[model samples]
Target chain A: MRETGRPLLAWVGLAARLVTGIVWIVAGGLKITQPDASINAVRAYQLLPSSVAEVVGIALPATELVVGLALVLGVFTRGAAVMSAVLFAAFIVGISSVWARGIEIDCGCFGGGGTKAGAASAYPWEIARDTALLAASLLVASLRRTRLSLDSLLFATRPAERAATEGAMT
Target chain B: MSSNSKASARAQKAAEMRAAQNKREARRRILTIAGVLGVMVLIVGGSIGVSLLNKEDVKAAGAGSSEYGVTIGESDAPHSVVIYEDFLCPYCGQLERATRKDLARLAADGKVFVEYRPFDLLSSIADYPIRATNAFAVVLEKSGPDVAKKFHDLLYENQPSEQDPGSMTDDDLVKLAVEAGATEGDVRADIEGLAQQAWVDKATQEAADSGVKSTPTILLDGKVFQDGRTIQDMADNLMAELE
Candidate 1:
């Protein structure tokens, strides 16, 4: 019944959805092309065993791409947003751990990752970026009925339907 | 009045029916979302499972032998220094230039055992790394580690700029092998022919399996040596460790 700022909130959700969606697509696309580089990037973190890292390296890009597609299309928007949030949170933890462990590596978020000459300085910025994306994904997850979304088209009751239902109720 | 009451009852029935339809639609939407998420999870998990299953355990394949890499110095040395290097990696070159003599001296003095794992990590970008690694393997196989060590230094010395990496040819590597004291006659044929390419491939995979993802990954006594970032820092760290 409180509908004063509903449109504004929907617009915010739309923006959040698009931002995280496009980022995931781009990041996943870049990594998928160079899987070996991706694997090396995961290995650079030095957190997981080689076997686990290899599997993650091979599978992560596809997961990112699917999540991105779902969010961008606004189909299963909540589910995709939740997945995005989880991934960004994991990335944040990984970056923080590497920083704490004194390992120097590129975050490898958008592709090109390995041991670099002066990569430690970039960890803070990478964490900040992931944290921001995580926040945006959380917003999208909470506001599942964003404007101009497939969820709205497929799931939300249309104005005509709402009117008919309300008329019957009254 | 009777007609009015009948119409109101009909209207109430229609509303209840509409509400029921709306509920069903919401349930269907939730089910659809759940189904899509389930499919996504299956895809991610399935691919990861397949890849892990396919990934061979290279460590188990080699049986803890020097087939994985080349070791320099006495086994009885007080310390062990392991280095992973790619011939084409510029930073590896820099690190080698800085620490080559100190590491060798430490090894020769029986203070440290140095192991060099040359792998073709940059093969994704260029085949030159693989070729160079193959050449190193050939030299090591034919002439042994002393000449191979010289060949290693020479490769770094002739390392092309990353911009023009392909400029260095197999002939160039063969020439370096000869200069480094490998037997001139058959060594040239072997280096150019990539006679030890299989060994190079095996060693590279073994290095990767061993978690040497980046070049110049130095492990001191089986632990990552991360005391510094710069070549100077690495050089200083190695020297300090000797004392």
Candidate 2:
């Protein structure tokens, strides 16, 4: 699976890449306008210390934006995919913890400063969304190549390496 | 095929395996490069985010300025009650609900001038308080003192439970004002233009500077009222100060 080169997989990778990329950009863009609200949103989970939450709240949007742009442009496919996976996974953990604590909260993934949000887990759909995005992220990370990716152009494999890659896949 | 030739073919396969390993190595290099670059971009963007988040450009909202607060009663009222409040604060809500009419009566009688200063300590608790404060600031700026106080009371009356996330929006605020007989006229500007933000920020900063540590921080005739004062108490104090 690691070495296999399938044109079909490339298409799947592109789909995942674009979808995850857009989600990150949109989520980050919405929160950037209200940094304080963004901070509140981070603190909503009760997972981090207030000071730490403040930093994450202020910085996460920017990181998400950068990662999104990278993924959409297909500039750094593997790295962006990994970042997407980490972020989604972190969100999953946060939501799950809040649910476990019987605490109410909004994920604040979009906007509105995430304060006093009623139970986040009450909406199982959010958990489901993050899970799906996580899967997409993993899929993007696994594939060595994707359609319209800069990876192929700048990091083209030599014929010898290509043959070896195929061999390993087999 | 001869045995020697067949053996050579096996060796060639082994070489192909090695070449594949090399390709994997090269792929890793590419991934590493991209990952490094991605992290670098995030660092740059994050620094900008941090700086912007920490930055607060505050200015004096103005003395007796309607932009930062609303004044009730004649300017020359012998004593004044300056209240620093957050509309979404449950405590402030309690205080407001408790003494609203009495304070108005005091104002009507011109026994004391009442000023409500909107501050934002709980901006991190939820966006609504800040949003509401910003909206109130707008009302104070454009809608005249009467409408501003009305809008202010309306906000406390309608404040969602502290646990509700993203409850109030600018549209909701504008609608409330219109319902209370006020026009939108540049209300959007006051809210969106952040025209009142600097003033609110200044007021909040000054409140902090003046050792105001909590909501309902009331100053009666330039003295901090250690105990929360009710309307009756306020009237009594006015009389005492007059004497």
Candidate 3:
């Protein structure tokens, strides 16, 4: 039963990792390509002050790239997963604030794509996507040991083997 | 024989453990490399796609030497209007589309001489290699007035969304110039030389000196046109002054 479950768990982990990583990488790369546009989008939120927005605009994309790469590679997977969750949580909050204020503008997530005009909106959809991604990231972070990962191999080292090696060295 | 079998079993177990560890390590390395390469490919591919999608069309419009000082309307109809605009400004674009026909008619009649000075407002906000004014300066210097006017109209027509900020590239600017009637070589050389930039900077400083604070600032015979929101309002004011 454990053996059967192990492959299933690893497959699930792989799916989560790929989804989160691709989303982050695409989002980050888009922003980097149009840095000024990204900065303008951040400024439109008016959540952060000018100076802070400037710094955040410059650093956020690069940070996303690094975190996304680590998660996909399954190296420092837990740490990267946690960071991605936190970042998405912050983005959700920001989007919710703007939506609450009745500001009609695109979130600028998937580049220049804008929301439709009317009572119905894209804000809810954006928040929902981010929330779902956050959950998946948190799950991966908590379930640190997965098949085909460095962490699994490292933790799999046997205590008996370690003690035998120590005795031999002495 | 029993003791030998026990030793063989222990050795086999150790070997199996070592093989498992090696397999895991190999898989991990392969996955890592694949992930990194995938990311690099996405970034590079996405960037290229964006550049292609955002490519600007440059064409030089012909007004020839008369382009430099060519006035739009009546040369002596009693009013002279100069417009300072930034191509990236949404408001400027709006005004251009709304009032272009009227402005052209007024300029063609030689009654109102229209001068266009393209300036940049986002230069302070963003680090763009090609300033808004740079394109205008290039068109003005190389293509002449008629082409400059055409180029200016085309830019406003293709202005980026207000939510996004950035200027057109030099190549795109040159493409726009050629569409406006200036030779591609001349536009390229002028933009490359950066001489047009000097003219843009000087015009911008002069506009500031003349107390122009915002884009699409209209000056009538060296006087600011206050309250000229619409094209009709401007024409009415101009006619009223003449009457």
Candidate 4:
């Protein structure tokens, strides 16, 4: 710890931010390509009223893409983190609700999120993934700044100070 | 030193510290407000972009029957059977293999009109399925319905296993058509063309909009037959549905 000099917690938050962004981008990119399927995936949840489900389904992939890009680029990290946390929390609730209702479905975290038989027991793992993502988003939000981030770039006045402080290379 | 004056000085310093803290909070509020506005712009802008792409894809698809499904029998036929299918799906292949003869018989007797509506769900996962769907549209557009049916059957007969990475290319499919007695006039060109890619997307979109979720989704006069698990069961269900 002494030799490395930087705190491990900062590195953890940075890693979480990047990974969470990647997941969102991939999920959104895949779903955006197949909008109708994305809607059906949302419908599979059977959580929202049908009208609300339609709106959420149509808007979700686009929102994810934007948030993911912002987070990955370290532009508006806190805001993107906020969006990520909210989406993951919603996903966790959706998965849990469906599991409790005995509705068998694929989590649609990926492309083929649809209703099917025999996958009801897989809810816990799905919830776990979302929970992890939620934690990551929260951590990223709480951090004041990270290396290679836009926020740090804005705050640091001198080039030397910026170069010296950006220790988030890993 | 007067004790009262010292106490007042301390109180003034505390007030100044509180003022600075409030200023920091205000700046943070401003940053967060900008952040929210920026995110909203991204979401709305992205949604618009996606909508535009969807429209462009649909427009490029060009001349297709809004009537849904490719016809296989007399229009005046008393019964209607619509088969929603994805060529690369294993279960779809099974359903086609199992019910092909019966479906043909039903069509031949003028008892039912069959529609082989090409639906795509596996294409997002694999390139093969949508490419084949495009090829099907190309063949249908150029060589009439009969030759298209032949092409469809041949594709199924020689379909690569679902896991096979190197699925049939358009060239191979054109060759299949030529071998199946297709008059190689522009049929091959159509098969090899990229224009049908939009058509494939459109067809798949139409199917998805109609709520066709899986391959080999069978409907008798628009009603899904849920109780049938086998050929005999399907046949029995068909007969029962007719009444």
* lDDT tens digits by residue: candidate 4, B1-243: 899999999999989997896686567657865875676687767774774365211111111234334677676788777777888876567667776777787778887777887756776557787777777777777777787788888888878765573567878888877765577776777777655887888778887766666656667766654344333455566666653
The full ranking of all candidates by TM-score, starting with the best, is 1, 2, 4, 3
Sort all candidates by DockQ, best to worst.
Answer: 2, 1, 4, 3
What candidate 1 gets wrong by more than 4 Å, as runs, is A1-4, A158-170, B1-16, B19-27, B38-84, B87-144, B147-243
TM-score of chain B of 3: 0.60
* Model 3 C-alpha lDDT per residue in residues A73-159, reported as the tens digit of each score: 676778889999999999899889878866555686755422222312778888999999999898778774654554443333455
- Which has the higher lDDT value, candidate number 1 or candidate number 3? 1
lDDT for predicted candidate 3 compared with the true structure = 0.63
Residue-by-residue lDDT tens digits, candidate 4, A1-170: 12124567667767888999999989888877676566657766766644565567668888888788878877778888988999999999988988887666778887777655456768888888889899999998887665456655444534365455555432
* Number of the candidate with higher TM-score, 1 or 4: 1
lDDT over C-alpha atoms for residue A121 of model 1: 88
Off by over 4 Å in 2: A1-3, A116-122, A159-170, B1-43, B46-243
Q: Rate residue B198 of model 4 by lDDT.
A: 79
Superposed model 3: Cα runs more than 4 Å off? A1-7, A112-120, A154-156, A159-170, B1-243
True contacts kept of each: 0.16, 0.06, 0.02, 0.08
Give residue B62's error in model 3 in angstroms.
27
Top-scoring candidate (lDDT)? 1
Could you give the DockQ of candidate 4? 0.13
- By DockQ, the best candidate is 2
